[model samples]
Target: MADWDDGYWWSADGLRLHYRDYPGEGLPILCIPGLTRNARDFADVADRLKGRHRLILIELRGRGESAYAKDPMSYVPLTYLQDVQLLIDELKLDRFIMFGTSLGGMITALLATSNAGRLAGALINDVGPVIDPAGMARIRSYVGKSISYPTWLHAARGIAETQTSNFPDFGLHDWLAMAKRLCRLTPAGRIVYDYDMAIAEPFRVPGGGEPGVDMWPVLNALKDIPTLLVRGGLSDLLKPDTAKRMLETLPQMEEVVIGRVGHTPTLSEPPCIAGIDRLLARIAAAG
Candidate 1:
């Protein structure tokens, strides 16, 4: 069994960013979780890939065990990019491959563009430059809201009901696992999600605001690097048309669509795992 260790890296803004390091012999692969998610999201995937790669899962500021920023505005993507850089520096890793899902993917895209030299390659799961507005709006609706449930079973049921669109195949145990990962028990005996919900407030405020700065320029910067993009076949956020366009723009990019999945494909699924194996093989061959 691979041992997982917890560590912290201090950010430029004085925040302590938490992370999990799964020990392995080969190259390092940094796993970045989705919006409102934490390092535990990759637990199963990390276990699967442990022998081949050292999996480093970061708990971005305001999420997981990481400290929340005093300034809620610091929760934006740019701040996250800086935090990633700080993490890399603390780890003393010269180069690393990235596995990013959703919001994490956006950060990967930003790094691939601004600091290509530091990246070995990138694997973006179910996210791209152009996001669906309806999806964004839906996310905004719950991003910052406080969640309260009478019991873990109730919370699991809530996730099953509300997230059915994204995870239709998840079973009871899966929901329980998700609940465990997302919430923690406090001294007062109340269960609360690990993330500071306030971090999501900025997105809720009505503002077409700067149109989310074009990321095509960043994607263009990843042209020479080996890249793999995984899209859920039923995803509403990264539509098939957009994925096709992404491939058109980056001819070297490889892609896979996991069937019966939506928004994001948790790599634990067999098909998704197979796709990842192929992707890592390609990266190894290229090296």
Candidate 2:
């Protein structure tokens, strides 16, 4: 049996988009990936929640199986946010839990402020209102660059070399798994990044590189809801102080910081999984 059914929807601009549908009962968990990531990043989360909750792992435009945008500028966050809303409408979701990572997390924050009533719960992964300049520079350095590997082994090694410090505990096996998620095999037998290289075009615009939102209001919107905040202990994107301020903003918020990880933590970690479970439990209890 297939683990998930292939799902597709159309973006407002007429681009076809895709997602992984892991069916179950009760409130669904809408999983969103980072800027360069796709539905594959949520595989572990789906594996854990498959039979327990409906999981919709979205692949934003220009990533994975989704069609690339005709207008490169449409790759901005506002477009992504609009795409997600369209998906929500397409699915007719009355209320749902959000599992957003990095750029996805920003979308969650925006939704929290605009669609507060539709949110059952939220898990903001490895991001806050303020993004660390160091992390911003690091992301700008590599996003949208065209690089391909002749073999899977070479692809795994390339990912490991660049991400070793972020995930110190990841082994060759782990890296190979990640490489499979982040890359795709071309018909010519070369492996390359799964996203459109043109998605980086917006970053070249003045003040367009950063999310630029005053996120405090976005965060405050979650105050009345059951929100879970996750951070990587060694993360350069979301500093410890920012995480602390997030907690201060909503004292009742639940937090999980996975030690030794940087940038973001895969929800597969024990602590991260437990935090998600706790949020789900709270949502269930309230309903």
Candidate 3:
């Protein structure tokens, strides 16, 4: 039995993109994964709510099965926003709820500004207007790093070693599952990260480390729509103070903090599940 149907879309510049379409009832729910992550990250979350809502999981350009941009600079968030818009238009999605993580959250912020009237609701996972420098450094250190493993077990151990601080409670089985999700087995018998190394170019550009974009205006656009901000309580990317400031600006936003998790929360977590339920309830009530 097929778990999901394969779908494709073309970027404005003509690059082919990919997404996983999980069919169900109610309004569609679009899930956009974090930087370097693929549609697979949301598999658990989608399975949990299956049959209640149609879910579309996107694989951004340069990641997953999507074509890599000819110009690496096109990997920026604005470019990503445009790509998502094109996907929306191609799918003829008049309205849909969005679930975003990390870079995906940034995309959601901008989409809210341009597509505010069309959004049923939004779930931003562990990202905000101001990204923490410490978190940035940590991410930069690993992205595009030289990585090769002889065995799945070795790959899983590497992931556990590097990410244990982020998910302190993850056991051996959890790390192994995450490894299988993140690292793909090549026909040559080597294990490697699934995304293109060129995808890291945007991060190495001059001034890339700085939060050059003014996200306040974009976030302010979220006003009037029901929004949910899910943060990993120990998250370094989205500081408590910044989330506080965000709430101050968008008082209508519902917030949840998943303890011990860092950078981002796996929506499978109890708190995240509860938060999503509340957000969807609000969305359903809006109709």
Candidate 4:
């Protein structure tokens, strides 16, 4: 197992946040996970890359060990960006590589646009500037629901049902592993996901439900940065056409397509590692 320390910091609103800090010798790789996901999502990848670079896996407010926001509206991307900036400042980091997945990828895009000079390189997994409407709807359908399971097996099965279409090759072992990462076993013997259900407030409207944000400007802002984008073949959130558009706008960007998955890819996937390596090399060559 890769060695790391559990870190804590306060968001601007005084809510405490958590992150996993894997200290290493070279450049840093800060990982921002998908919405509603916790830091553990990057465990496998962190372990693999810990030997080469420092790894920081962040838990946004309301996820993992981070303090939940009293005001649910604090879950927006720009708000999350503020938290990330605070983390970077607190750590005294000058520059680092960013590895973002899903909503995390969107956050990374905004960061690239806002402060592309601070990044060594970046890799966005299974996300793009123009998120597909169907994908957002699918995310909204289950994000705030109060769902629980009676046993670990049940929870694992639930995860399989929820994600199998995106990960068609996943077996019992894969689902079980993901269950540990996605859910927390309560003292009462029930299994619940590790996120605050209130984080979904922005999406839930009085009559229309959750609304999506426009991120075209943020994506266009990453013009000069070296970036790698990953897409799942079965993904509904980031369609191929949008990915192509990203390539067109950010001429300096590259991409990798993973087969048989839906929303995102684990950074440990062979192809994902290759993409990361490509970005890392560019970062090294720049210095």
What are the root-mean-square deviations of the candidates from the true structure over C-alphas? 1.9, 1.1, 1.3, 2.0
lDDT of 3: 0.88
Candidate 4: tens digits of C-alpha lDDT, residues 1-287: 63999899998899999999998887998999998789999988888888789999999998989999998888888889899989988998888889998989878877776565788788888888666889888888889788899987898899898888889999898888888888998889899999999977888764222224567776776777688988998999989999998899887789889888788777677888888788888878877
Tens-digit lDDT track of model 2 for 1-287: 87999999998889999999999987999999998999999999999899899999999999999999999988887788889999998899999999999999998888777676889899999999999989988888889999999998999999998888899999989899999989999999999999999989988887665666788977888887788989999899999898899999986588899998997898889999888889999989878
TM-score of 1: 0.94
After superposing candidate 2 on the true structure, give the runs of residues whose Cα lies further than 4 Å from its correct spot: none
* TM-score of model 3 vs. true structure: 0.97
lDDT of 3 by residue, 1-287 (tens): 76799999999998999999998897888899988899898999888877898899999998888998899878788888889999898888888889999998888888887886788889999999998989998988998776989998999899999999999999988988888778788899999988888777888987563335799888988878889999998898999999999999997798999998997788888888888999989888888
lDDT of 1 by residue, 1-287 (tens): 43698989998989988999998877799999988899988999898889779999999999989999998888888888889988887788877889999999989888776666778788899998888887787777777778777678887887778778888888999888888877777777666777998877678566531136788877897787778899998887898888998999887788888888887787777777877787778777877
- Please report the candidate that would top lDDT against the real structure: 2
- Clash count, one per candidate: 0, 0, 0, 2
Model 3 residue 53 lDDT score:
88
lDDT of each: 0.83, 0.90, 0.88, 0.85
Local error of candidate 2 at residue 109 (angstroms): 1.0
Q: Which of the predicted structures, 2 or 4, would earn the higher lDDT when compared with the native? A: 2
The estimated TM-scores of all candidates read 0.94, 0.97, 0.97, 0.94
User: Which wins on TM-score, candidate 1 or candidate 3?
Assistant: 3
* Model 1 ranges with Cα > 4 A deviation: 206-211
